[model samples]
Target: MASQNRVDLDGNPIKPITICMIGAGGFIGSHLCEKLMAETPHKVLALDVYNDKIKHLLEPDSLPWADRIQFHRLNIKNDSRLESLVRMADLTINLAAICTPADYNTRPLDTIYSNFIDAIPVVKYCSGNNKRLIHFSTCEVYGKTIGSFLPKDSPLRQDPAYYVLSEDASPCIFGPIEKQRWSYACAKQLIERLIYAEGAENGMDFTIVRPFNWIGPRMDFIPGIDGPSEGVPRVLACFSNNLLRHEPLKLVDGGQSQRTFIYIKDAIEAVLLMIENPARANGHIFNVGNPNNEVTVKQLAEMMTKVYAKVSGEPLLETPTIDISSEEFYGVGYDDSDKRIPDMTIINKQLGWNPKTSLWDLLESTLTYQHRTYAEAVKQATSKPAAS
Candidate 1:
């Protein structure tokens, strides 16, 4: 479609606007950059400390959208360039955060600082400059659902009213302060509150996105191959590393915590809708997720095992998963959300956005990519002689 013919949800023709996309080298950022370049006439000032994931889009100056995107390497923490970049663009999307679960408990201070303190300036710059802001927050901010506090056998535990997290209705619940796992969530919730206050008190145009486990290709790095050998990544990458090395998936505390996942592509579509249709999206905290794709971590592991086996052309292991206590895997002060099922009413009505992928189908595609990308690397790493 031509830029002239591009229309938003309300039939308003969308204008080409430059977007200052912080953390543009991350998984979601990379995908969003691709979408904008391939489909829209909008320009992106991509800012991130690293461009490894988005190198494909940056290099080969002869590419069609080469002129449409520019990568600037800078850390948002203390960089004076952040404010200027935010001023340069009509819209700012803040996707920078320390979101990995492993760091939440072990590196609580860094997690809090990265997620909350570092984001303070971004929010301020957008508000001060009167720029439209699309801030990415995690579904973790919702913390554990109310139903989780109910008795294990209680009938209310199965009720949607108890567990379904509504952006407008549900309360944000977190464990005691000592849990430390809630550090990231607590920081995010604070930042979100600050953003809301800015919107209300200062009349800043802002949209908050609480993503529910957006997963797909180019997500967190594979162990040893890309990231630190001992670093623990998100659940999908953790399981992918295990599958790649033909090792049993480790199930933290029997992996009973349930979560809903949306394909990164599907979620990005919703984001694009928010970007184009600001009238409907602004002043609204939207939950971007596929409620229909809910599954316990154990179920996710089983499904991933099957999908990896099929994709890799390898036989399924007799013992595909091993249960380990959270203390052993994540260290002390670890906690988890009992369930996360985003209420889709607001997003559906506001943006007409609904995630379209099924769990099995998404796992199939993701696992196929994982196998193709990391299987050989894992094989080579494992074949190397052990260090003395």
Candidate 2:
């Protein structure tokens, strides 16, 4: 394999390359577009179906490096448009997909067709053009790890020597394929396979990153089924909002399920690192997250309550208790595994990258943001008096 660290002769660092990022409208991609434009030598063409959320970043004088980025309101499912965007750049990062569990559960067929089927053409295009492909995968593919600590064993041969885990350390899968929740995992796993095969068969330069539960600003924050999924709002945002508002921090099943989180910025850094080096990263996979950032639902509620009380001048919200009797909330084939954490030795050893932020830092920032937004929303809603 070529040296993972490919340096130019002068060693002064090459100018940032050009990049086209698909799905740039979503939470992660939007942040990544800005980060790349400001920090890397690469200029960016950000393409997504025009959405207000992403358009917020495109406002004049909003993004410090806005000139370095060209925004395209194109859909990834459109092959011709996608092809044009892919061919114009040196690297293409695809983040478009039904990312949340609830969203995927509600629209499995659509998710499969759009993200899986639609992405194949882009993969093929990148292969033909010899442009590097950076595709997003999820830790959900691991299913569930049975143990408290991650097992040390790993089957991934291309992983950096220092990053490999033992046999028992890889992620675990639960129940069976019949469960609807597994559809997300199934799709993600299939994409990983496809990327691996494309790299081996067609000489496509591909990098796969499976990120754990990463939460921060811009995360979907509403509660209920129509709310985000894989437990997005329920886990972080809900707890934060309730705590801030002095409402109950509802818990399902005593909040026992455990998960690890990495800040969005750290996740973005790992993706960029992979895109920069194809020789070492091509056909390789890495888990991007902070191992130190594990927290259970019960623990999260408590933490949010504590943080809110400490930060806000108002009295902390009363912690309302909820019964764990609902089987639908935490039944078999519904939510699997009690804990999930990544063994970071691989990415750290190979790319010299590791998640830098703590979960508290992410949570605090999220809480502050939510408080501000919610406060504004309340002001707007209450400003108008009720009609007789």
Q: Pick the candidate with the highest TM-score.
A: 1
Error in Å for residue 318 of model 2: 1.3
Residues 211-315, model 2: lDDT tens digits: 888777776555422233345443566665555445687677677777777888888888767766665566778888887887887777777776666556557
By summed lDDT, the worst window of 10 consecutive residues in model 2 runs over 158-167
What do the candidate models score in CA lDDT, each in turn?
A: 0.94, 0.69
List, in order, the clash count of every candidate structure.
Answer: 0, 15
Alpha carbon lDDT of residue 110, candidate 2?
A: 80
Model 2, position 319: C-alpha lDDT score: 48
Q: Give the TM-scores of the predictions, in the order they appear.
A: 0.99, 0.82
**Model 1 TM:** 0.99
> Candidate 1 has which clashing residue pairs, if any?
none
Q: Per-residue CA lDDT of candidate 1, range 143-175, in tens?
A: 999998899899999788999999988999999
